[model samples]
Target: MLLYGSTDSGHSYKIRAFLLLTASPHAYQWIDLALPQSHRLAAFVAASKFGEVPVLLDQGQAMCQSNAILMYLAQRVGKLAGAETEWQGVLEWLSWESNRIGFSLPNLRYALRWSAQPPEVLHYLRQRVLADLARLDAAVSAQDFLLPSGPSIADLSCSAYLFWLDQVGIDESAYPHLQRWLARLRALPHWQHPDLAMQAVAPDTSLARDE
Candidate 1:
């Protein structure tokens, strides 16, 4: 198996973290999207029709979309679903991660870190992120992980972008539960910092660009 992704991509890191957590062995191919003509490469487009990072190549099959990949890996490893209702809860949190935390927080980081978005735009995005963060805090406050069964794909999916909150000046002090949840994840035996775990041959400095 070969996992195609960029080191700077949160989406890619989500998949990488899961593979590590499961002790799944696979080779990683770094895709430098910042390079000129990278998107136009026939090989890359064949692996990723949408010209995105984090495509998992299993045998001859290519998988796209981060959350979709998470679900696939979870099922493959028998870690995502337990009880029918618990599986449903995992799916629910997966949707929330993609729609709420996944979209807002990463964009906010991009705007703050690399983009030239106007001050008003940044402010608007920040407010939205705070709301999403508050909701996430509330959801995870009652337990160590999203569901009673313990850490599932939902936790990894949501935490991808969140681990970088400090880089964007987002304060974790307001959400102690979320912070505790992150600490628990870090303590996992196979866990590694995304930057150290996912290494690209060449870093994409232009990752903040809206794709």
Candidate 2:
């Protein structure tokens, strides 16, 4: 299996973290987003339907989108898939993460770290992130993971970006339960920081193609 991604992307980290935690065998190819699309690996550009990172090539198939890739990995490994009874709930949480924390957190992080946004835009993102964090804290307050069955892809999906909360100046203290949940995830065997989990591979100029 081959996974294509960028190190700084939380979306990409989601798949990398899962692969690491499950001890799954896969080769990771780092696509330097700083380069123009024309200079990216031809195979990656062809495989990525949306022209984005976190594209997984396996069994002669290319899987795009982070949440979809998570679901595929869970099903393939038969681990971290949640209980069959809770499958619907797992899907719901994944959807929620995509729409909620997934939307607010990454954008906020990007605006703060990579590029500057207008003050009003920054305020809106901060507010959305706070609300999403509160919702997550409340959800996990009574349980150790998102689903009662224990850690699933939903937990992995939602928690990936939160690891870099400090980058966006979000105070972790405000969400104790969320913090604890993150700590629990860290305790998982084979867990590594996102940066370490998805290291960059030297770009293969041979694979470069025109856009």
Q: In candidate 1, which residue ranges exceed 4 Å CA deviation?
A: 38-42, 201-211
> Candidate 2, residues 1-211: lDDT per residue as tens digits?
7789997899999998888889987777898889899999898999999999989888888999999999999999998999999999989999999999999999999999889999999999999999999999999999999999899999999998998998988778889999999999999999999878767866445433221
All models: lDDT?
Answer: 0.81, 0.90
Please report, as a residue range, the 10-residue window in candidate 2 with the lowest summed lDDT: 202-211
Worst 10 residues of 1 by lDDT: 202-211
lDDT of 1 by residue, 40-110 (tens): 44656787867798888775678899989888888877764445578888888889888888888888888
Best by TM-score: 2
Cα deviation at 12, candidate 2, in Å, is 0.6
On lDDT, the candidate that comes out on top is: 2
